[model samples]
Each structure stands twice: as C-alpha cells, then as structure tokens.
Target: MTDTLIKLAVQAQFRTRPTLRSVVAQMLTEHLQEKYPPLTLPVAQLRLALPREGGGRGLSPLVEVALDYLASGIFPDLTARDGLDAYLSDASGTRLSFEQNGTRHYDLAVVEALIRELPVIVQVGFQDALMAYWNMPSDAGGSRWQWFAGILQDQLRAAAIRQLAGDVPALQRINQLTDYPARETRSQRHGPESSLHAYSVQTRLVQGETQVTVQSSDLLLVDGKQVWLCNLSGRIEAYASLDAFGQALGSAHGRPVYRRQPHLATL
Candidate 1:
C-alpha cells in the first residue's frame, strides 16, 4: 500500500478519537493482517518473546518501531542501546509493563539490549523491510507490504536456522563437517563466512503413502566436493557431491523418484 493510503487510514481513525496508542496499533495490525498473511505466525512468535502484560501477548517491537517511523518520518536510532531505549520510550504510550511484587513497573533495557545485539545481517534485513514498505518503487507489482513481509520472513527464518545450528544435533554435526581444516583456517583469518544454502526436495514414498508428497525443504552446505544435507527430522547426511545426493535419494525402491530444486538462501 502507498503512504497516502496509510495516512488516510490514520486520519480516518482520528475521527473516532480513540486512545492514540490503541488506535495506531489496531490500525497497523489490521493492515498487516490484510497485506501480509504469511507473517502472522512469525510475528506472533516474536511478540511472545517480548514481555507481556494484562494477560495479552506483547506487540512486536518491530511493529512498534515501524509505527514510530511512519508517524515521525525518522527511523529509530538502533545504533546504540541508549538510543533504542529512548526511541521505544518516546514512540508509544502503551508501555510493555509488568507487575513486580504488586507494583506496576516497566523497563526498556532488555528490549534495547536485544535490539543492540541483533546480528548485522538481521539488522540490515529489518531496515530493508521497513524501507520497502515506506519507499516502495512506483513500478513494483503486488502489494509493497507483501514484499516487506517476505523480507521479514527471510530474516526470521535465517535467525531460526542459526539458533537451530546450536540446538539441533544434526545441524551441529553438519556445521562441523562443513568446517574442514582448510575452511576453518580461511574463516579464522578472514572472519567467518556465510555457508548456509536452502534447497527444496520433492520425494514420493510409494511404499507407504501411495500419493506424491512434498517433503519439507532442507538446508544444504556445499564445501568443495562435499555436500551436507539437514532434513526436517534433524537428520544429517553427507554426500560426495550434489549428484551423489540426488542418486542416494533416487536409490529408494518401489519405483519412487524425487525432484530437487535450488532455493535462494535469502539471508
């Protein structure tokens, strides 16, 4: 949607003269739901990570920041913890507070720290998403909000995969396997590099379910002649090459065949 549409909606809401915080938030949330249906689950998960109050899930800090930027035309200063603290404090009247020992209190320190410590790439991704929504190109097709939503999804998915690397045994093993001596040395000397790649594999298991079923997309890390695959079940398999990986999948019985497609790893 265009800025004119958003500004008009905000103006219309002003006719009701509702609470500023509630009106702005409700408007933004409704717009988000209409323009970006795919973001609902991820945004909900992010909201859960924030401190909640009054038995309601916390609103996403990104959404709060977006609202501030839209209203003020000045992006939040995410460069420092203190800047983030000030921005969040000044942006909205709805404080994400909690009751401590029967006393109501609020603190932005934790949220500020979280924002400050966000990975550089993730920070960039969020900035891009916001910019896409605010300064959409005239020739762009479909809703600019949907494009913004896709970028947010990619960022969240990448963050989840990074977290999984530490938590999932199979992913951890894949990481280790991909980190050979040469690669480790290179990374140590030039800083760590991004190696994660995504691929979609469609396989049919004729023996069990006689229907063609699509398998969950997998993460792949290709290093030289070796390729590592991490499936949805946290199973890690090593193949000498991409061809070998495909051959292994094709080796299954019952006249079963599989199709593979490369996916853009938009991290």
Candidate 2:
C-alpha cells in the first residue's frame, strides 16, 4: 500500500507542490476504495513520517527510518528513559538543567517525558545524516560516517546557537521567515569567511493602492535596510538601497507575502 501510494504520487502530474496528505487521500479514495477516517489524521501523518518495520519496502519515509536505524544500531541500548535523559546532555556531556539565564523555559520533567514519548521529534534530518553515512562514496576513507555525523551535528548546533547565545528573537524571526527549506547551497565567495549569508524573502509593497511583490533567492544579508540583494553568480539580481528595501517590507496589514516571483515582473 505504501509503495503503491508513493509511486502514484511521484507519477501524478500537478501544477502545485504535492503534499503527503493529499497523495494519501487520493490513494485511499481512488486506489483502495476507502475513505480516511476522521480520527486517523494523526495516524496518517505519523505513517507518512515513519517507515514500516523491517526492510525491502520501496519509498519509505527516510527521516523516521533513520531515527529507527540510529536507535537500533548506533545506540542499541537506548530505552525510553535513555532518550529522555539524552536530551539534557550538551555536546560537552554537561547536563543542561533547563536553567539558562536564571529562568526556566521548560519543565525538565515535561520535556523529558515528551522526548521519551516522541523521540523522532527531538531533531530533524536523522535519516539524511544516516544516508550520507551509508551512501558515502568509496573514494572517502577513514570514518566516513563520523565525518558525515560531524557536519550534521554542526548544522544542528548552529540552529540552536541563538538559544545557546541568548538571542531568542533573532532565532524566532529566522524560524518565522524561513518556513520553507533554506537555500543550503553556498557559493565559495559567500562562505563563512564573509559576514554575508544567502537568504530568500518575499516583500510586499503598496504602490499607489496596488500591491506589488518582490521575492528572490539571491537576497544576501537579510537584515532590513542594509541588504546585498545582488546575485553573486553573475546573474546581477538586485542591489537596492536601504530605504527602497525597507519600503518593500513595509506593506499594509492583511497582505500576504508570496514565496517568489519573476525579478523583472516585480520591478
């Protein structure tokens, strides 16, 4: 059932982005001659995120499978209690007491219980990290999984850096604006050596009672006003002035920001 659903989903032609729920609904309706039970929404979501027990099935959710693989393989001894306690430990093995800034953000017991109950929700991309490890090419030598794990670990660490450094609002804004997958591909010139970071943003502006939308992937340095919107890959996107960019972000209430649109059309 899972394999058939995924195959049909991949084959289905659509004008918009495909969602797991929509695919599953179509499958149950057309293929299986069944209607999705109202109470099964949570189960449906969970099944979409998890792979079936044992192997040989094609097109399983890689993320959940990765978590299961990690639980059984790398940390074979892990139990519910172990997962709960594991969340409290930092990279240096120091136990976090949930007492940062002399204020507690979460009850330790509550968080521990949550972790114990839903271990997969602890983090994302476990399957991606695991796949990178398993699928490492023969050319790479000496602890390939370790290298992959290290990079994945670093990315996870970076995501939490704001919370670690006590910049909660910056982290919140980042999470808010970056609802879609971030542009992970980095250019050599735009790497860590430079202070600039690539970002995608949609800015809605009101021009004489008409709503205009500006969106781009080449938007480097997202800090409003002082932005380097130019595409460094010789595309020559935009290098708008501070006030011009600010106005783009300062639209009236109830206006929706688009994901992206043509550059020249926005202008």
**lDDT of model 1 at residue 100?**
55
| Prediction 2 TM-score vs. true | 0.22
Over 1-267, each residue of candidate 1 has an lDDT whose tens digit, in order, gives 344664565354334333434444444444444543433432222231233333323334555554455465554433333222221221232433334567343334544333343332334445554554445432234454444434333443444465555657435434343342244554565457634343446555454434555564665656556666655433556788878876776674674354433332421
Model 1 residue 128 CA deviation (Å) reads: 16
lDDT of 2: 0.36
Runs of candidate 1 exceeding 4 Å displacement: 1-215, 257-267
State in Å the error of residue 21, model 1.
27
Position 27, candidate 1: lDDT: 42
Q: Write down the TM-score of every candidate.
A: 0.25, 0.22
Q: Can you write out model 2's per-residue Cα lDDT over 1-267, one digit (the tens) per residue? A: 243553454344122333433333333223212221222222222222112234221222323333454365432222234123222222333333333557442233432233243344323333443444455542234354444434333343354452324756444333332332233333242343432344456655545557677664444344343343433222322335545654554533575443222232221
Model 1 has an lDDT value of 0.45
**Largest lDDT belongs to which candidate?**
1
lDDT of 1 at 106: 33
